[model samples]
Target: MIRNDIRALDAYHVPDASGLIKLDAMENPYPLPDTLRRTLAERLANADIHRYPDAAMENLREKIAARHGLAPEQILLGNGSDEIIQMLMIAADQGACAAPAPSFVMYELIAKWIRRPFTAISLDEHFNLDADRFLQVVSREKASLAFLACPNNPTGNFWAADVVERIASDFGGLLVIDEAYAPFADRDHLHLINEHVLVLRTFSKIGWAGLRLGYAVGQASLISELNKVRLPYNINTLTQIAADVLLDHFHVFDEQATRIRCERERMQRALAAFPDLQTYPSQTNFITIRVPDAGQAFAHLLKKRILIKQLGGHALLENCLRITIGTPEQNDQVLEALKELFK
Candidate 1:
């Protein structure tokens, strides 16, 4: 038999939206412009498949570091942020790791997988950090790690900077500011980094989901410690090329991010006009709205072939539906579907 703990847990589930207007995952719905795509294809076609990936990945690291204004030695790349989180978990194998309840679930799940005791401090009713409670619990647990998702996933709002700064200053363990949605957020925690703090960012949000590139920034000593546990060749050659090309053309991605941010605001304003649905303001690319009956609305939207996350099961998300901000026509379709359901 498998380990009892492993046997008892449900695997992370990804829904099959084979033919639906898929918006469940917080992903960029945009595609690369045709000219760029062709240019990228040419680059990939000529890459050195005969050799292994850059063992140091120095070129990609330099590009990202220069883009973010960090020293290349301060960076460590991951297949995606998940593997980076895994490395942190392995390095923090000394004690419990904590995050807010109703957070990005992987923080808890990965900690549990590694058998590190995990704590999920509950967010307040408004889904903001209960800073005092958070400080108290993590201190009590002598937590070895803390993962905070900025413009936090599922609920989608930024935790206050002052409170996070205290956690950075006071926590007994490593603190990770998971900024998977930073391209859309107003502020970042990189400036707050200390020896114990790391900031995670992913290119997935900027139309690079297929590339699976996420990197972290921290002090050289901290990053080197985390890198010790990283599997060699964790990043593939093709992915390295793709990421570098994408970073070189970051202006194009920036334009797309600008558009997504604009659309997120427009979607938020529209969600506000719904009498029956109470929507929250988000600093991320999606909005969560409370429906009178989320299950029913979720079902009706499914019938209409629109896929969004219905988060009724989590205590914090009771009657809530998380809808990713899609393209303009896609948003129009979602609005019409919701209007029909509100009828």
Candidate 2:
């Protein structure tokens, strides 16, 4: 028999979305434009695939550090932001713990897999963090790690900066600020890396999801501890090279992000017009909207070959659905389809 936790655990499900508009996964809808795609193809065309990747991936580290205005020593790369979360749990040396409510799902799942005690501190009715309760739990120091999604997923709202700062100031334990959606958000705690916080970021949302590149920035000592638990050469040669190439032409990534931001704002405003809909203000590239019946809306969109995420099981997320901002045309299609549904 498997471990009791493993047996009881429900595996993460990604809905089959073949031939749909595919907005459910919070993915960037645009493919790399022809020029960049060709460049990436050319780079990989003659690359050495036989040899092992650079253990340190120094060049990629330097590129990331320069982009963030940090020293290379402060950065630790992971296969993806998900791996970075696992590394943080390992670094905190916690077994099992409940994460704050309405955060990224991975935090709780990872804790359970590690057999750590986990509890969720539910957000207030508006899906905002209950900082007071959160502080109380941390002061108890029962769990070794606490995870916060800065611009929280599903809700698509960024926590107030002052609130996060206050928690960092008060909490003595490790605080992981997962900024996977940072590129689209205006605010971040990246400046708080020297504090009791570790900031996790990734290229997944921006344009390089397929590469599985993510990084954590923290005090050198803490990052060193995380490095020990991470497998050597976890990022392969091609990924490192591709990340480096993309970073070198980061303007391309920025342009795409700008487009997505525009699309998100347009979508949000249009969503606001629906009588039965409640659209939450978002700093990330996705919008979370409360509908009269989210499951029905999700099913209706599916029938039109458009897909969006249904926030059914998530706390405080009842009757809500999340839509990733797509290209101008895709956004129009979604809006038109949704208009028909609500009309």
Candidate 3:
């Protein structure tokens, strides 16, 4: 019953963390403050679980839009940004999708899941976009959607906004600027939002991953088109209530992001001092390092009960490992482990 293409592809895997420091996924390390947790419990107690979620989800949608300076009509909710990516692919039934090679795997993965032809244009050796060539190839391929993971995944570097907008405009298709890491970055491409550009966001990085809420902000018409393919009442009732209450206390996340940025810089400086470990510049909440032997370093860290993302196989990331910015204590532990391994 399954399509042959589906059988040929590997299922995306999440590493087990039964007993580890747990830094493989890019998650906020801090827990909700006791005060907030108590308040949240009180709020969650009020939700009507016996009924289906509000199909419109207008209140929650409005609050999210207000936070981003976008209109409610311009936003489309998803179980997470993952679902929105699927919706984009399902709606783009006519043409191909393109994204930078070794960026976000989901762009190509979801495209193929929907049987959409996909193209992955390679970034330069340092993992930056080669704008002219990327534009040329994507345009030639007649791609209907091009994904730009700003402060892109795995590599964690933001591409030049203007250059990407030009590339998308030239390709004559929708351009999704996946800003999953923008909360930690100093800059963003909101200045480039227009008819052809769509911005994707998720609460995952900001400590709301468990709630499974994400949104797309774009021109009203484009958002409407994507919505047609989205399942209604996708955001559950409890999640909607929790999101509203948490967003009302949005300053907590802002403070957490501030601390994470400081920790990221400190982590990078410490990683740079290690022998045979070169660190990449990052605007995201994680730091990616290239160790002399990623296999050895990864095994050593695993043995020490530290779990970080080992990105291998890609020629560009031959020895790379991405370490999420954890709490101060977690980072210190990782630093200590690196010191022992490097020695």
TM-score of the candidate numbered 2? 0.96
Q: Write the per-residue lDDT of candidate 2 for residues 174-275, one digit (tens) a residue.
A: 888889999899988887776468899999999888899999998878887789988988998899878877887888889999999999988988999988
Error of 2 at 284 (Å): 0.7
What is the TM-score of each predicted model, taking all chains together? 0.97, 0.96, 0.97
- State the C-alpha lDDT per candidate: 0.88, 0.84, 0.88
Better of 1 and 2 by TM-score: 1
Report the lDDT tens digits of candidate 3 across residue range 167-233: 7567678888888998999787776778888889999998998999899998889888888988988
Candidate 3 lDDT score at position 51: 90
TM-score of 3: 0.97
Model 3 CA deviation exceeding 4 Å by range: none
In model 1, state the lDDT of residue 44.
96
In model 2, state the lDDT of residue 101.
Answer: 79
